[model samples]
Target chain A: MLSCREVTLLLSESLEHPLKLRERMALKIHLAMCDGCHSFEKQMFSLRGVAKQYVNGLADELIKCEDELPPPPL
Target chain B: MKINLEKSTKTTSEFLHDGEVVEDLRRQMLKFATQQLGDFHLAEDAVQDALIGALKNVTSFGGRAALKTWVFAILKNKIADVLRSKQKTVNVSSLQGAGEEDENEDFMSLFDQKGGWNHDDRPSQWCDPEASLSQKDFWIVFEACLDHLPPKQARIFMMREFIELETDEICEAADITINLLFVTLYRARMRLRECMDMNWYQRSQNHAELS
Candidate 1:
C-alpha cells in the first residue's frame, strides 16, 4: 500500500510514461479505494496537459523564428 | 608552384565560406541558448563568442557531430564561463538574499495552509490548453515564472522540458550527476507549479468572478 506521498511522486513520473504492470495494478487498486489519490491523479493529468501545450507553443515560436533567421556572417 | 598556391588559396576561401555556415549554426544555437539562459543579452553574447571561437578553429570541426550540435556545445561552454565569472563576483551574503526571505516565507505559509501535496483540492478545471497557450498574457507569466527559478535548476529544466533534450544529454550538458539532475528538475517543477498556481491561475479566477 503506497502512502499518498509516495503515490504523488509516482503519479508525476507515471503520467510521463506507462507504469509497470504491477505498479499500474497497485495504483488502480489504490485509486479505487482512495478518492484523494484519484483526484490527485486527475489534477496531475490536467497539469501535464497544460504544461505540454504551453511549452509546445513556445517551441513552435522559436522554431519559426529560427527558420526566418538570415544566414550567418562569412 | 603558382597553381599549388592558387589551390591552397581556394581551400582557405572555402574555410572562410564555412564562416557563413558557422553563422547559421549560431542562429540555431541562439534559440536554444536564449530559452536556456532566459536573458537575451547573455544569449547574444554567448552566441557571438561561440562563433568567433568556431571561426578561429574551423579546421577542428571534423564532422563528428552535426554542425548545430558542435555549435551548441561551444555555446554551452560560453554560458558556463559567464556563470562562473558572475558567481565569483557575487558576495556570499548577497547570494543569501537572493529569493531567500519573503518568497520562501510566502511559499512555506501557502504550503502549510494548503496542507502540502495531500491537500491540493483546487478544481480540475485548468486553463484551456489550446486557448491559454496562444494568449500573450500566458507567455508573459510563463517567462516571468521561468526567470524566477534559480539559475542552475532553470537551465536544466529548460533544456529537458522546454528544449526536449534527452536526459543523458541534459546531464552531460549541465555537468550534473543523475541524482542532482533529478533533484534540480523536481525543485524546478515544484516552484513553477507554485508560482503558476498562485500568480496566474488565481488572478484569472478572480477576474472571471468579477466579470
Candidate 2:
C-alpha cells in the first residue's frame, strides 16, 4: 500500500504524466482507503481550475487596458 | 534584411512609425507576443496582422492606447493560432542530465515516522469551493498564495499550470530531469494547496464566525 506521502507525489505527477500501471493500481488502492490523500487530490484539481481563471482575468485586464485617445484624424 | 525585429524591437518600431509613445506601446505589444510565441519573426508577423486588423476595422488608429490594446487582443489570437500550428514542431526537447534543483525539498514534516499523514498537516475537505470560484476575493487570495511561492518553484508552477506547458517541455526548458520536475512541481502544489486552504478556506470560516 502506498503511503500518503508517496501518494501525494504520484497525484501531482499524474497531472503532468500518465502513471505506470503498477503506480496507478497502487494509487487507486491507497486512495480508496485514505481520506487525506483523496482531499489533497481534489485540491490539486481545484488549483488548476483557479489557475485558468487567473490567466483569463490577466488577459482580460490586458484587453481592457485601452486608452481614451482622441478619435483618429479623419 | 528581415527587419531583424527578432532582437531589436525598437529598431523595428523605428522602421514603422516615429511617434515615441506609439513605438513604446508597440514595444509592449511585441514583448507580449514574443513571450507567448517564443520567436521574434512570428511575433512581428502577428503584431503586424493585429495592427492591420485594428486599422482596417477602425481607420482612425490615432488613439494613444485605444488602438494598441485592440491590437493586443487581436495579437493574442494570432499568437494562439501560431502556437496551435507550431505545437508539433516545437517538441525538440533534450532528454539529458539530472538537475540538482529541489534536492533539499523533503516532505518529512508532514508525515509521521510510519509514513501516515501528520495530524496537524493532514488535508481537510474544503467547503463550498465551487461557490468560492465566483468570488473576487477568493481569486485575490489565490494570487497572494501564488506570490508566496519560492521563485524557482513559482516559475515552474506557472509554466506548468498557467502557461500549460508539458512536464517534459518544462524539463527541457529548465534543463532538469523528469524526476526533478516532478519533485519541484509536487512541492509547489503542496505549498499552494496548503496556502489556499489556510488563507481562503479557514479565513472565510473565521469571518463567518466573527460576523
Candidate 3:
C-alpha cells in the first residue's frame, strides 16, 4: 500500500501527463476515498494550468523576438 | 541497397528549403536555452553556437529525435560549456555553504510529512500567462522567485512547465531520469509557491496599512 506521500507524488505526475490505466485507477480510487488526496489532485491541476500560462508567456516573447530578427543573409 | 548520390543531394536540398522547419527549431532552441541560462544574451549566444555546430555536422543527425529536440540537446551542451567557462572564474570559498542547505530544508518543510502542500485550506488559482505579465509587480516577483531556484530545478521546471516540452523530450535533452525530473520539478514548484505566497502577503499588508 502506498503511503499518502507516495500517492501524492504520483498524483502530481498524473497531472502532467496521462498515467497508466492501472496507475490512474489506483489514484482515482485513492482520491475517491481520501479528501486530502482529492484536494491535492485539484491543486496540482490548478498549478499545472498556471505554470503552463507562465511558460506560454515566455514563449510568446521569444516568438516575438524571432519575428523581429532580420532575414538570414542571402 | 545502392546509394544514390544525386537523390541524396536533392533530398538534402529539399530539406534545407523548408524554412519554416528551421524557424520553428530556432524558436524552440532559443526558448529552451533562455530558460536554462536565465540570461537572454547567453541564451542567444548558445543558440547561435548550437545552430552553427548543427549546420556543420548536419550529416551526423540520425533523425531519431525531432529536430527541435536535437537542437535543444546541442544547446544544452553549449550552455554546459558556457557554465564551465564561467565556473572557472568564481571563488567557491567565498560562498556560504550551510546557508544553501538551510534554504533547501526550509523549502522541503513546506510539504508536510505526507508530501503535500501544508496549507490545504487555500485553493490554488490559475492565472493566465499573458495577463499576468500585464501586472509588472507580479512579473518582477515571479522572476525573482525563479532566480531563487537551484539551476537544474529551475531549468527543468521552466522547460517542462513553462516552455511546455513533453517530459520524455526534456528527459532526453537534459539527460536526466524521469524520477529526477519529477523531484526537481516538485522542488522548483515548492520554492516558487513559497516566494509568491510571501510576496502576496506583504502586498496585502501594505494595502491594509495604506487604507
Please give each candidate's TM-score. 0.49, 0.61, 0.50
Tens digits of per-residue lDDT for model 1, B89-154: 312232332232223422333233333433553323334433323345554565677778776566
Clashing pairs in 2: none
Candidate 1 chain B weakest ten by summed lDDT: B89-98
Instruction: List candidate 1 stretches off by more than 4 Å.
Output: A15-18, A32-74, B1-32, B35-42, B45-123, B127-134, B204-211
Tell how far residue B144 is off in model 1, in angstroms: 2.2
Which tens-of-lDDT digit does each residue in B122-169 have in candidate 3? 324423333333344454556667778766566667666655667776
Pairs that collide in candidate 1 are none
How many clashes does the backbone of model 1 have?
0
Q: How does candidate 2 score on lDDT? A: 0.64
DockQ by candidate, in order: 0.12, 0.27, 0.14
Worst 10 residues of 1 chain A by lDDT: A65-74
Off by over 4 Å in 2: A57-74, B1-103, B129-134, B204-211
Give lDDT tens digits, candidate 2, residues B46-120: 878877765556544333344454555566566555544543433223222222344565778889988899998
